[model samples]
Target: MIERGEDWVPPLPTGERVAGAKRRSGEGAAPTHPAKRKAGATERARELRLDETKAEYRLWGELRGRHLNDYKFVRQVPLGPFFADFLCREKSLIVEIDGSQHAESLTDESRTTWLNSHGYSVLRFWNHEVLAERRAVLDTILAVLEGQIHSPSPGLRFAPATLSPVGRGGGASHG
Candidate 1:
């Protein structure tokens, strides 16, 4: 993911591109909380629209209300100061899917910093991972969750772990 100003944005996968209608460029200017609208109304709008779009619907089918492995997840979950794509409240976990533009590393870094600071474990998958090999992505997410369940929290932070770019993946050989 890349950070242009403040938001951490992930890359868009090659084949699956978000249409221009959905792209919100120059979004850095929008306040995280727009003072003009009441907070409840904004939240309700987000909630109501969750299932109104294809991407959200597909993701909801995979994750809503324990749809996967009976593992309960709340959609459009509000955590800390932001909304999570999928959250398991019991585990304090967040799952986010990044698009192609996030290929620039900075965006992911900022997102990690925020999530880590909030005592949440975030697992991110590239859009391609979700689109091309969803099973693999799911397996990785499950493994992370299982590990967290067994161990004491390490208070992990996503501070520049060495990564092999996607196509060159050597299985994320970490330091």
Candidate 2:
């Protein structure tokens, strides 16, 4: 039955199918095609999530695709089910911006741990540091890439003070 919402036009011949018909719907009826999964496709998906943060945006402009100093870095990096602010595949590094809200979330800790387990180093910068001390933050990232600052150890220590009170133990706070 041709419903009001369904396509009224006739279907294409079996052999005259469109190249993107199956891709747009994310259905894999046929054998997997390597060309459909390019090496940079993951990076491209991450790039779609960029937002306009004054500091983050500016940094992005400077370091987009590692344009700055020719050091390759991808913005809005997708890892697993989450997205990182920035990622360098070559160095297996991720840079994140942590706001006051982030200080209280166990989710960040879990995310960091997951990334670490996958051999990717995670560096988190406070929002204030990103805004007020942008250069220092960038410098720190560069230094890490330059092999000056050793990556965090396998067992990273999370300071209790940074965790949300409830995250530490108590129930969720109303405020």
Candidate 3:
């Protein structure tokens, strides 16, 4: 062993160095960065859950605790490189509530594509729809879950009155 200068750094393990080289050259699996990214995503999910939008909180009340048709749902779930607003692992479904910021967003499009490729059906509703048209939103979700409405390829964007309620007036009050 030889003494080193104050600014000298130790060499990485041989295997790690090789993996790092491979990653830099784009010739091998990513070198441990994905796990760190996942951890970051998890932390972001937790933060989002803590500061949930009003629409998200309202929808969660209806979806949590196996409340909807007794199917379990988890909110702010981390998935691969993204966090789904709500996910039902058993049903392979994801529900995303979008605000105005999501309008025509390329990032959202790619995120939806990634999610679809992972075998989950995504249902999207605008924040206003979730807040002002709560019944329709819930009905559409239930319809998709029950196979009454086929899962759209990739994902579906829903307008406030796009789908009518299952068996009653469209404006049925949740209260």
Candidate 4:
């Protein structure tokens, strides 16, 4: 064994506890807290909420506290293994804001597929779209929340959310 400082210890994985470390899946190996695996995601999600993007901060202003047609939305929610930007449990919907970094991103596709498979619809908007066309974005979100945009394609990376026939919904993209 190598000598080490008393203060040093191996970093533990999220949800891991010394009490439950030895449990196996045969007879009695289940964790004491079934939600242990989410502990990490939960912490990370909280951090994301605290460090929200400018676009997220703007859109959240409209979605928070039932400001949008009485729909209650939560931010930085953990679902399965991913954290969603915003989620409305009543409608089983998730809304994500992306920067140019997300254009044509396979990761977003896979995450959307996973969320869709788990009975949730996802809506994505570019950061530019959110900041430049606040009304239309909110309208698109409102339309979705009201079941008017059922089966929303949710704006592919290159596409934009639609509020009307005028623009992508009625605005131009900065990105």
What are the per-residue Cα lDDT tens digits for candidate 2 across 1-175? 4332111112243433332343212332322221134345465554455444676776776678666556788776544435567776666667876667776654555455444544567787777787888778778888877778873533242111222223322344342
User: TM-scores for all candidates?
Assistant: 0.55, 0.58, 0.66, 0.67
For candidate 4, lDDT tens digit of each residue in 32-51? Answer: 22123344565677788889
Q: List the RMSD of every prediction in angstroms.
A: 11.8, 17.5, 15.9, 15.6
lDDT tens per residue, model 1, 1-175:
5333222222343433222222222122222321122235455547545444444456667776676766777765543334566776555667766565756644445445544444566766666667677677667667665663333223222122222122112232232
What lDDT score belongs to each candidate, Candidate 1 first?
0.49, 0.54, 0.62, 0.62
Candidate 2 residue runs with Cα over 4 Å from true position: 1-50, 65-67, 151-175
Task: Predict model 3's lDDT versus the native.
Answer: 0.62
Residue 155 in model 4: shift from native, Å? 5.3
Q: Which stretches of candidate 1 lie over 4 Å from their true place?
A: 1-56, 148-175
Worst 10 residues of 4 by lDDT: 22-31
Q: Name the candidate, 2 or 4, with the larger TM-score value.
A: 4
Q: By TM-score, is 1 or 4 better? A: 4
Better of 1 and 2 by TM-score: 2
Clash totals for all candidate models:
10, 1, 0, 0
